[model samples]
Target: MPIITRFYGIIIKMYFNDHLPPHFHAIYGEYNGVFDINTLEMTEGDLPNRAVKLIREWAELHQNELMKIWEKKVFKKLDGLK
Candidate 1:
């Protein structure tokens, strides 16, 4: 997966050029995961103790923006807001 965004305890990524409801991949060092941008569900993978906490917080903080980026990306928006 491509590393799109990275922060203190999280890394946001999109993969395989596919989009339905919009989601992102998050990684926190020893912990990595695939999460839904809409419901904030941990669709797959595991996160470490601190990573889990940070992932939850980061996702909540950027949920809207993440979803928006996913939408714009898949839809091929010319002036996409990233």
Candidate 2:
């Protein structure tokens, strides 16, 4: 997974092999959660209150770009491409 966003001890990311429904993972140390790009849904797990708020803001800020990336089904660079 690539570290797409970072703030408040949380690292938001996505895997090259992640499935559709357009989501990314928010990881805080040993904790993790899934956030949907479309509906802005916290699909799985969570973070502390302030962290969650920050993440929500981050997600919203990049909503359009995230969805654009997801919909295109593009991965930054796969292993063999190197």
Candidate 3:
């Protein structure tokens, strides 16, 4: 997995040629979740409420860039929540 962002001790990552629905993985300590890019919903797994909220907010902010990268098939770390 390649980390695309890190903030508030949370790490966001995605794998190249990954499974469908356009999603990414969010990891916070022992907690983790797979979030759908468009819906910003947790597809599976779990994380703290605060962390999840932060992640959703961050994802919303970068949705356009994320989708662009996804379509471009480029794997690169993105700036975390700011």
Candidate 4:
């Protein structure tokens, strides 16, 4: 997995040549969740409430960039939420 961003100890990543629906993985400690870039819905696993909110906000802010990267099928590090 390649980390695209990190915020509040939440690590956001995506696997190269990953599956469909344009999603990313958010891992915090032992918890992990796969979130859709377009819908911002958790597809698998779970995270803490604070982590959830932060991830959602960050995803919303970077949705476009996320989509672009997904479309290109590339793994690049992204700036963390500020």
Global lDDT of each model?
A: 0.67, 0.71, 0.89, 0.88
* Candidate 3 accuracy as lDDT: 0.89
Output the better candidate (2/4) by lDDT: 4
Error of 3 at 77 (Å): 2.4
Arrange candidates by lDDT, descending. 3, 4, 2, 1
Q: Name the regions of candidate 4 deviating beyond 4 angstroms.
A: none
Note the residue pairs that clash in candidate 4: none
**Candidate 4 local Cα displacement, residue 60, angstroms:** 0.6
My TM-score estimates for the predictions, one after another, are 0.70, 0.77, 0.93, 0.91
lDDT of model 3, residue 27: 96
Error of 3 at 63 (Å): 0.4
What lDDT does candidate 3 reach at residue 65?
Answer: 81
Looking at model 3, the pairs that clash are none
Clashing pairs in 1: none
Looking at model 2, which ten-residue stretch has the lowest summed lDDT?
Answer: 73-82
TM-score for predicted model 1 compared with the true structure = 0.70
